[model samples]
Every structure is written in C-alpha cells, then in structure tokens.
Target: MIGTWVSILPPLIAIVMVLATKRVLLSLGSGILTAALLVASFAPVETVKHLWSALTVSFWADGELNTYNIFIMVFVLFLGIITAFVSLSGGSRAFADWAVRHIKTRRGAKLLTVFLGLLIFVDDYFNSLAVGQVSRPITDKHRISRAKLAYFIDSTSAPICVVSPISSWGAFLIGQLALILGTTTAVNYSPLSAFLMMAPMNFYVIATLAMVFFFAWTNIDFFTMKKHEEIAQKTGQLFDPEKEIPGQLKEDFPEHNYGRVLDLVAPILTLVAVTLGMMVWTGYRATQSLNIWAIFENTDVPLSLVTGGLIGTLLAAILYIAQMGRNETASYRLVGKALSTGVKAMMPAILILLLAWSLTYLIDILETGPFLSTVVEKSNIPVNFLPVIMFILAGLMAFSTGTSWGSFGILLPIAGTIMINAAPELLLPALSAVLAGAVFGDHCSPISDTTILSSTGAGSNHIDHVATQLPYALIAAAIASFGYIILGLTGSVWVGLIGVILSIVVLFTIWTVKSRRQIELTT
Candidate 1:
C-alpha cells in the first residue's frame, strides 16, 4: 500500500468519519488503526507495534527527544495557564467591558480581529492563539460566534505568514526555495528576490484575504457559519453549550473589583515581545550574522514560543496574585485551582493535536505525499495548464496529509523542475501556486494543526469550526483557481490578480442583490 493509490485511504477515511460522526478522536483513531493494519499487512501484533511507534514518535524520534513537538505542546499548556490567570484576575471581564464601550458594533469587533490576525504574522501558531486571546472578549461582547472568530483567525494566520518574509512560514519556504533554485541553472534570481516576487503571484492569499475583509465588514455569511452567527445573535450563545470546546475554562473564578484593561494587555504584549526577541536572539546565535532575513531563517521558532509562553504565564500569574491585596474575592487557594483548571481547559486540544500528529506521521510513512507528487510529475499536461494543475495537486496532497509544510517539502522542487524544463518563465508562478494551494487545503483540512489551534484559540467546538469554515474556504479556492488559470494562460501576474479581484467583486455583487431580495420578502 505504501507509495500507491491505497496509501490515500486512511486520510479519506478519517475525514469522512469526522464529518459523519463529529467524533474527532474516534475518527483519528480509526485512521491510525487502519493505517497500521495496512502497514503491518493485517497482522494484529505488528499492527499494535506500528501503532505504538506512531503514537510515541511525537515524543521521541531517532533516539532523541522530539523538541519541536514537545515544546509546541508546552507552549499550548502555558498559553492555557496564561488565559486562566487573566480571567482569574478579572482581565477578561475588564477587557470585554472596555472593548464594548469603544468598539460599539459587531462589525467593529470582527474588523478588530482581522487587524490582529494580520498584525501577528511572525508565526501562524502564535498568530492564531495571541489574536484569539486579545480579540475574543471584544468579539464575544458583540455576539460574534466562536466559529466565525475561528474562521477569521484561520484565514489570516497562514495567509499572512505565507507571504511575509519575516515569518516562520516564509523563512522555511525561502530555505526550500534556495535549495530548489540551486539545482537549476535556468533561474538567476536569488532566493529572497524570488520569494518577494512570488508574494503577489500567490493568488489564493489575495483572494482569501479579500474575502476575509469583505466578510468582516459586511457580516455576509452562509452555510454552517450563517447558522452559527444567527444563533449567536439571537441568544448570546457563541457556541453550542453542549459541544466540547477546547481552551474554554470549565470553572468560573471570581472577578476582582479593581481589575483593569492593563491586566489583559500587559501579558499579551510580553508574550509577543519576548517571543520575537527570542527568535532574533536564537537566529543570531546560530548564524553569527546581523541580516534580519538570515536571523528569521535560522531562528528556533519552537524554542522561542516556549520561552515567550513561560514569561507570559509568569506575568499573568503575578497579575492574579496582585489582585489578592485589593480584592476581597481573591484568595491564595484559587491560584492552585487556576493552574489545574488551565491544564484541564487545554486537554481536549492537546489530545486532538497529538492524535492528528500521529495520523500525519503514519500517513508520511505510507508515502501518500510522494505518491501524489509522483502523479503530478508524471502528468503530460500542456505548459499553459501546468500552474493550475500544480495548484490542484498541491491542494489535494496537503488536504490528504493534513500538513502544508509536508506538501511544500515534497512538491516545491518538483514544481521548480517541471516549470524550468517546460517553460522557465512560469517557474515562480507555478511555485506560488503550490504555496497558495497548500494553504487552501490546510484551511479546509479537519486534521490540520493550524485548523485545530484556531478552534482552540476561539474556544469553538473543533468540528463546528471545520464545518463552518469549509464553505468560505471553497469560495476563495474557486476564485484562486480561476486566477491561476488566467495566470497560466496569460503568463502575467497582474492579469491573474485582476481576475481574482473581479471574481470576488462579481460574486459579492450577485450575493448582495440576492440578499436585498430576501430582505424585501421577509419585510
């Protein structure tokens, strides 16, 4: 089954089961077991061994600790603790009251979230959690649904990071592009220049970002998102109370009378500042150089995340303790309870993330990504259609593997080689297509870590987030596909960009006309 069509079954099964059952863990478990059985040739004992190995690889791999996964998990826990302390110190309530006063409408709240999401472009992981923590109170005050908040966070995090040269995603992709360009004599542009050139050529990012702004400003929603929004507006319920919400505190703590907005703003600022500083420090240590791009390229992102999370947790804890002197409801015992509650709040997200990682690991071992890449490499498509074909294939690969980075690793070089041999002029556009498609698939994939984090950050039910965001993602993807086709046919980035903008404008115009008709009927 490895490196064959059968290798695709596990992810397909997992995705179908998740949508059908809304039981994330069970669905992931089924996929893991199925993949193990396939790898073991249906032998029960070997399957058990494969399953154990797959599960533990996230903790330990290649005879050493897997610092990347472990540190990211630690960061998630620390973030949860920070949130608990902030709430315990009454920062959440204080911030909500302040934001409600200043940000008078739901549109203001949504646009605020969009701004935060775009502002925090250093890393997608950091962007998702930090933006959610800062914006959730304002959004909640204005009756914005958790699913909608997750959508905003998800849309901005990866799309912004993928284009920003200073971001973790950009650093990684640039490194890959350097290697890819090194192998070809046809391309003369430096890696950094090529990355900058590809930025505008990433049609999906433009389409998705445009839709995000439009949705935030107009509050136009459809499918499951519309239902979630309507429920929130009608009853003040941000999510279904019955569903399991990750990163939501189960126990309510007493609010201090003297709490201020500074209680919330200070810790978030510390987290962001410390994390970015550590990234530069770590990068400088590795490269003994002063170039900003080189620093980002060499930075230890997971280490920076953990360090910043620790400092943020400490600051939040100190803020809560300071409330003891001024507020009658503040108590020493609640400090211990806060830590426990914080850990408990993040358990659901952690479990789902671990399962998703395990499944992704097994999928890699099955060579699903390589198999998909092989299909694209072997296709004898016309040069004019190569960009769109690569976009679609890259999307399918990332969707099946639940990891855009994996698709990038596997497909980028291939895209470079194909375009260089077929038409060197289309190389950047083709490469940009891969990046856009990978993000598109990541947005739609239920098992994607970024998707899971966005749900956790927004305190939304995981399945609800996935379900609500799919329609919006598909709409953007369709527009991007049209744009890629235009780019392939005309060999002009500007024309493709115009095509994407026009597509969005036409769609929104039709939607607005239909909306007015519906309003007239209702009235």
Candidate 2:
C-alpha cells in the first residue's frame, strides 16, 4: 500500500466503469490492468508483462486451480448440468403444471416461490437456480413479472445463506473469522460463536426477508415491475422473447409429459441429502468432534460441495434419464447429450467467476484490507458512530469488489482487532455491521455472482434485475446502518430491533403511498 489511496483505485475504478458501461468483464479487466500496473511500480514494460501474466496465469493460478477455485467452478458446472437435465426431462415443467393447478392465484404463486426459495438454503448458488428453474413457469402462469421473480430469487439466496449455520456461506465465513479473529487474547472468538453473536444484529438480512413477505402479501409492484406485470398480463409473455437471455439460459421444453412431480422432488431431495451427509461426515472426520457447529467449522467445505455436486448430478442423471426413455441405451444417450450441453451452458458464468477471482487476488496483493483498517484506526470517530461508519464503508468495499466474502475477509479481522485493542464491548455490533453491510452490498451489486445467477436463473436481463433490486437493497442498508448505530449506543440487539421495525414500517408506508399514486396515475 505504498500509495495508500492508490490501493483503493482498483475497486473504485471497477465500480465506476461498471456503472458507466454495464460491461462487467471489461470493467474488471481494466481494473486488473490498472492494479497490476500499480503493482509493477508504474513501469510500462513491467506493467505489460504483469498484465499478460495476470491474464494467463492469475486467472487460473495453479494453486487455486488445484484447490479452492476448481472446487467452486466444478460445483457450479455440475449444478448447471443437473438443472439442465431436470429441465429437459420435463421435471421442471411437470412440477410447474402441478403447481399451477393448486396455486391458482398470483399471491399463492408468489408465496410458493418464496417458500421454495427459503427451502433450498444449502447454498445460494443452488438456491437461486433451483428455485428459478422450478418457479418461473408457475409465476408466469399467474402473470408475475420476471423482475419480480428475479427479486425473489436474489433476495432469498444470499440473505438466507448468510445467517444459515449449516450452509457453505456460513462455513466459508467461519473459516475467515477463525483465521482472522482467532489470534485475539481478549475474547475467545470461535468462528461459530462470533457468527452467533452477530446473527441477531444482522438487521439487513432480517429486513430483506420481511420486505419480500411484504411484497408477497400486498402484491406491490412499483417502478419497472408495474410495466412488466402489465405486459405479462396483456401478451401472456413470460420474458422478453426478442432480447436474448444472455447466459446459460437454454430452455427448450420438449413435450415430455412422462415425468411426474416426484421427478423434481426426488432429485432435489437426493441433492440435499447427499450434500448434507457429505458435509457432516467430512466435518466430523476433520475435527473428530460430535458437535455439529464444530464439525461445520472444521469441514473441507469446498471439496464437500464438489463431491455432493458430483453425486447429486449422477443421481439426477440416473433418475431423469431413466424416466426419459423405455430402454437404458436411449437414456444413456440422452444423459450424454444433456451433460455436455449443460456444462457448456455454464461456461459464461464460469468465465465471469474466473475474472472475479483474479480481481480479488489483485486487491488482496495491493493490501487494500490493511489500508482500510488504517483509515478506521486513524479516524477520530466516536465509538457508537463507528458501527454506522463501518457499515457504510464495508458496503463500498463489497459493491466495488462484487464479493461480500472478500469484503468480509478484509473487514472482519480489522473490526476484531479494533474491538479487542480499543473497544471490546462494541464487538457484537461491529461484527454485525460488517456482516450486514457485506451482504447488503453484494445483494445489490450488478457484477456479483449471486446477483448474476439470480438473473441467469430467472432469465431476466441483468441490468433490469440490478435496476429494480438496488433501491430495495439500499433501503435495507439504510435500515441496517440505523440498527448498527442503535446497537452501538445501547449495547443490546433488543434495542436494535426497534430500528429493524422502523425500517419495515418505512418500506410498507412507501409501498402504500406508491400504490395510491399508481391508482391516481391510472385515473
């Protein structure tokens, strides 16, 4: 961090370029080039060399390729394959057909979507795609907008995983906390305990969940959603058929009424069962602990996901292909085609993920985290105001990087160090602020994987999802900031609940006013 402020330039440049151009890949590439140039001491020749090496090497560094990166990518690929196979076999269509029969109303369709989203809490990536695959038709039948469907997918995905104790998100977060805050002498900060303490104070997660239910209950559609719903009603259009669905959204519904609703339910159950079993077994083996939390904290989570994905994918292929044909020979051929097509479909998302990882590595090399910590330590800000400050600043970091996990890695340690060294009692509030801010920012970011996947799943345009969801995410952030301040001032999560209640009330009031205005405008 030789140029302390320069360290911030990479992510800031990424953010600005994204807003200006909407080309996330180009923006990330430019940011990487700028950061690499800075890293190479601003020498032109060295900078070019650094840039080439980054493009060729860092994006798939052997270290990460062998261990962590490969696992994430592999799981995504297999998940894609499973989703594809399920769709081609009429599992998704069959389920939707069954659902629309019973769930005749718009409200029931939306609530069912929400319920399904909440049910698939094992991983956000899995949750987003799975819910979208199953629920899109149901929602479309009931005239729900793609924007609204995308919102439901995005809202439930990350926020639920952030607080879920047994999720991959939780495991990864625990690893970060254990690595960073485990050094403290003042507090015994086991990763699980830290997460537990901050859970109640995670106001944004709670508020976002509440906001979705509000939307479900009241059937509020303001902004672009109103127009979308109108078009859907008039034209029976589920998506913009003219504008291509940009990513791995190849949906060809062949008439395969052979499948039952159980075809969908069975595969999802197999995925869940295999994933949870592997997670527990691996965790227990690693830690030799009967305690589930300890087991979760100790598991080789990334590898477990890969294994689970592989097994679940295999089971899905067997179940789907078996039902697709009269003989095993034909089914085997179908499996081959589906697997190849599905994995290939995921290539776009995989490429984006690779670029994201490369950018994250560059930010880490620039020591951006330490620079941020320096800013916090040097500021003469009051202790109570610090929570709000941390919340806002962390949002900036996550928004820039498009990764809550990366921002969490940077901020959690800094917060812990500050708390132990100067303000011990404010530990819970500060931790809460970091977690809440990271999720809120990533929840809204256009380039974020979760956000991108939500759009991918719903087949909504990415910019549309970003434009529609950002306002709501910002509202959640504002409320979380207020909650953090209350927690800091009162030293109790109970008091912070007041801030949460107020945030929901404000949102509902706005919805009320917006509905009245819509009525007026129509008149």
Top-lDDT candidate index = 1
* Candidate 2 residue spans exceeding 4 A from truth: 1-3, 42-45, 52-64, 172-194, 241-248, 251-253, 323-336, 490-492, 520-523
The per-prediction tally of clashing pairs is 0, 0
Q: Which residue segments of model 1 deviate by more than 4 Å?
A: none
Candidate 1 backbone collisions, by pair: none
What TM-score would you give candidate 2 relative to the actual structure? 0.88
lDDT (Cα atoms) of all candidates against the true structure = 0.93, 0.76
* Tens-digit lDDT track of model 1 for 1-523: 8999999999999999999999999999999999999888889999999999999988999999999999999999988998998899989999999999999999999999999999999999999999999999999999999999999999999999999999889989999999989988998999999999999989889989988998899867899899999999999999998999999999988755677898899999999999999999999999999998899999999999999999999998898888777789888899999899999999999999999999999999999999999987787789989889888888898888899999999999999988888899999999999999999999999999999999999999999999999888888889999998999899888999999989989998988888888888999
Residue 85 in model 2: lDDT: 74
Q: Please give the lDDT score for candidate 1.
A: 0.93
Q: lDDT (0-100) at residue 457 of candidate 2?
A: 73
